[model samples]
Target: MGRAPNTPYAASRYSAGGDGPVQQTAFIGQAATRRRLLGGALMAGGALAVPGLVRGQVLGTPSLVPMRLSPDQLVDMKCCLRPLRAAGPNLGTESVGGKLVVHNYGHGGSGWSLSWGSAEVAVGKALASLPRSVAVVGCGIIGLTSAVVAQRYGLDVTIYARDQIARTRSFRASGSYTPGSRIALVEPAGPQFPDLWEQMARHSWRMFRTMLGLPGEPVRFGDSYAVSDAPIERRTWPADPAITESFATAGLPRQNSEFAHLDSRIADIVPQAVPLPPGENPFGMPYATRSSQMHFNFPAYAAILLDEFFGRGGKFVNRVFHRPGELADLPEDVVIHATGYAARDFWGDRTVIPVRGQTGWLVPQPGVNYSLRYRNVSALSKGDGIVIMNNNPDLGDMLGVGDSMELPNRAPIEEAMATLAAIFARSAGAAA
Candidate 1:
């Protein structure tokens, strides 16, 4: 049916059509022809899509931009807590200061990923109130997006924030497409949350797709590899009971009671996870998977969102609200509350708590264009910098569950870089 490994116009094994002597000579000739074809393909920046070829055996030409990372290469670090809400991002409304306040904060770690979808929900509720204008609190992803969405809805939008997008907590994110990362306590958010989360995630995915080829390549998707010494078993959400216990967080929606199972819900939409054949494994690890994911280059993306907001006649007011009464001072009667972690003190929402996340960056390396995760350490090559973050908490027992230390943790950064150094060493050895 198909061409044989070393034969042209090859006959099927079951076929007895070819004369044995003629077929033997043709096979040898085809081998040399194939080699010539391969050489030509490599010269043209292409690889033969030959079926059944193992991955490692035929390495592609060296990467155009060579990169080797070391522990001492670390240049900067950013840290922030995901403002987790027990009931998920508060997209509904609450009455405050004689105005309809649309709660759009507490998206946890999914702020950048879920901004568009959640903004849509928040604006829908605001428009329903038939307000002439809207006041958006905060200038992070949620606030910026909320302003843009409001402008599109024909509402005069004004953003009030303590810091602009570049300095906001949202900028501290790793900028991955994790729409449901600790978004809420499963039990408190209720069975209905899956539908809401799915709706937001799907909508956000559509919006992000439209920005693929824009200037700065603000939103991007690229290949990523996950490697491990042990089999990378497929895990369903609410991970094994014991493992879930390790993720146990403290707070209103206690980890014991609110373990979220949202990851599996949107698995069908995100890049499909597939096991890599031994030949395809890049890390030379026993187990590995290759996939692609959407990553936000926050600096570029933030600039785009901010520019769009300003171009649409949106106003930015550097105002901070410390309490609910501050809402009365705003010129508009409709408000979108996207203050994120600040909601704990400003709006008196005790349900909001922080889950600390930290990331370190090596100076920008424009050539490296891939991401890798192994042994709980992850790295992404971004235009702003080469991001390296340890997903596992530095504290021995916390596992980063409910822990919310906002300050930078140097130990984890050191450990993460050490792991990457080892990975690069192994990779160099394999190449040698």
Candidate 2:
């Protein structure tokens, strides 16, 4: 890994030392030490420190909810390949089969995160042609959102899909607010996409805010604890010349190939991430950070979308298109393609790659409201279930970087549960 880029936050003493030529890890450790001393000083003086300081510690046996993730408790298993594209999402227009088609697919894992905003863009293009009736293809998050937005735009929108939300790949999503997760290959999307990505994320976030506190608890926010037993490594991500060159043929420069940090750009909008003090770490892990995160309970959330769509006079046609020519049979002059991975064969899109993800679900624990990702395994405790996904093999160094398995592998699920059980076992030992 290269030296971290000299961003203002990265240059802070807590990140990289303010002094010249400091090793990033050593400087961060020093900052952590300083925070520990400060916390101790406040405790010795009998002075009531900040509200978050005492409550956030997890080093000791804090009132942390134990996650019951034993193999016997596992209830379900599901997997889906994220429709990843190198150039972000394909929000473009084309005249196909005498129809004004607005391509709005290829959102990757961020389809749910960017649905509203991407639909806004696609529908804007559709509206430019002054079409009275619009056809939305697919029924995943992107398709459902596009249909709803089109209806809101005063168009008679009809959704054509082979499968409903329950059967679609979107149902398998982890339902986190991860806008950049496999959104685009870092190089091919170029520099301009970061701005557009932010716009979409911000718009969808506003909509998500409105959905919060609604019936069924479809949209909600919760706390998460990130615990790591190993030393935190910081990498100065250098611009890849190969990626730059690849995008150059597509009219993009190397400097413009990297995706900008959305966290830095929208710090005010998202919840603030706070590091836990030494004694406050409850997970018995060496490093820990706790923060609030937005989550979409997908099962309930998808049902609400369908309910609202039907309530608003939107229509759904149970149909599937085998190829682009089949789309012409539909009775709409305008078509919005929100067909996730199916676009590969339906529209002959070679860039639509299938990146397989294997996941397991445990019986829901109402008390375990928080989520955690440790050692390449992630667990989210939604109302439906405790969704667990293994990113890599047990004790593996790296997660699935370019994995493309489209089929389910039961072995990963078994490995994930075993690893999760071990983590809880270790925590039990520490607590006892």
Candidate 3:
């Protein structure tokens, strides 16, 4: 992976040798050397440090909650392929055998995060046809949201998909608001994409904010911490042309630099991460940052969305389309093509790249409400379950890019659990 370009809040700004305050604890004897050795060992092993050795508890700082991260606690695992396109998502209108088809798929990992806003775009195009009814080809988040938005426009809508929302790839998402995650490659997407992306992201953010306090807590905000033994590096966009050009032959998805970091365009609307001083850092890692993250509890959120759709007279047809010609058979003249990764085959779109992602779920904990990222492992405690994912930056954006295997692998999940176990074990040692 290439070196990431720095930003204002990059590691240099908050590192120990940077502008941040330095630790002033006195080291008077050999005991201090032993403590340093122990800290080095824990850091090398990807473990947290003892609280007493770091600093006394900081006021208002919450203690880290332990999670049952063993393989035995794993209830289920799911894998899905994110539809990635080098030029970003296909959000244009086209004529399909005399039928007006609006494209709304290929958002990559940002499907869930950008659904509402993208739906607004696709539905607006569909409305221009002045059709009495419309059909959505898939029941994933994108398709479902498009149907709901169409219903809001007083257009009779029906979804035609082989499976419902629960079985679709969107259900396996990490559920965080990550609008810029694997969205598009920098050179291919061109200059105009950032402004269009900002429009979608800001609209989606506002729509999500409307669901914050709804019944069943479909959407809510929680603190998420990114902790590390070394300074945290934040990647910026407009990577080197040589590096961006290598992505085509590398046979892997574009790395962080190659992807457009459109989230920064809406930075003012989104919560900014703040560096955690030693006292406020609960993970005991040498460096850490915290930011408010919005999460979607899919199980509850899906139910609310489906109920609202059904109540508004929206219908669903359990059908599969083998090719674009099959879409012409539908009763509606206007169709929102939201088949997601299936578009790679059905629509003969070779640009739809498959980026595989998997998540392991553990039974929900009672009071574990926050999220954490240590090393390459991430744990999110949502209302449905605890989502454990391997987001290794060492692999860059190519972590699971170009892979289409949907089978769940336990080895990765078990390895991630071991990492979490080590962190919690050291946390317990500190509490003792």
Clashing pairs in 3: none
Clashing pairs in 1: 55-279, 56-279
Residue-wise C-alpha lDDT for candidate 2, range 1-432, written one tens digit per residue: 554443222211111113211223223334455467547846774212322112212113234456666678777777787777778899999987899899999887788889889999999999998999999999999999998888888889889999988899898877878786667766577779888988998999999999999877788887777767875443344555565344335432223224333445667788866777765665655777777888888878888888878888889999978888888788899999989988978889978766667678888776566787676677888777888887743313113424566567777777877776676666545544
Q: Which candidate number has the best TM-score? A: 3
Tens digits of per-residue lDDT, candidate 1, 233-258, equal: 76443423553332235454433335
TM-score of each: 0.82, 0.79, 0.84
Error of 2 at 276 (Å): 0.7
Q: Give lDDT tens digits, candidate 3, residues 290-386.
A: 9999999999889988998999999999998888988878889999999999999999998888988999999886456788788889889888888
Q: How close is candidate 3 to the true structure, as a TM-score?
A: 0.84
- Model 2 scores a C-alpha lDDT of 0.72
Which lDDT values do the candidates have, in the order given?
0.74, 0.72, 0.81
The lDDT leader among the candidates is: 3
TM-score: the better of candidates 1 and 3:
3
Stretches > 4 Å off in candidate 3: 1-60, 235-254
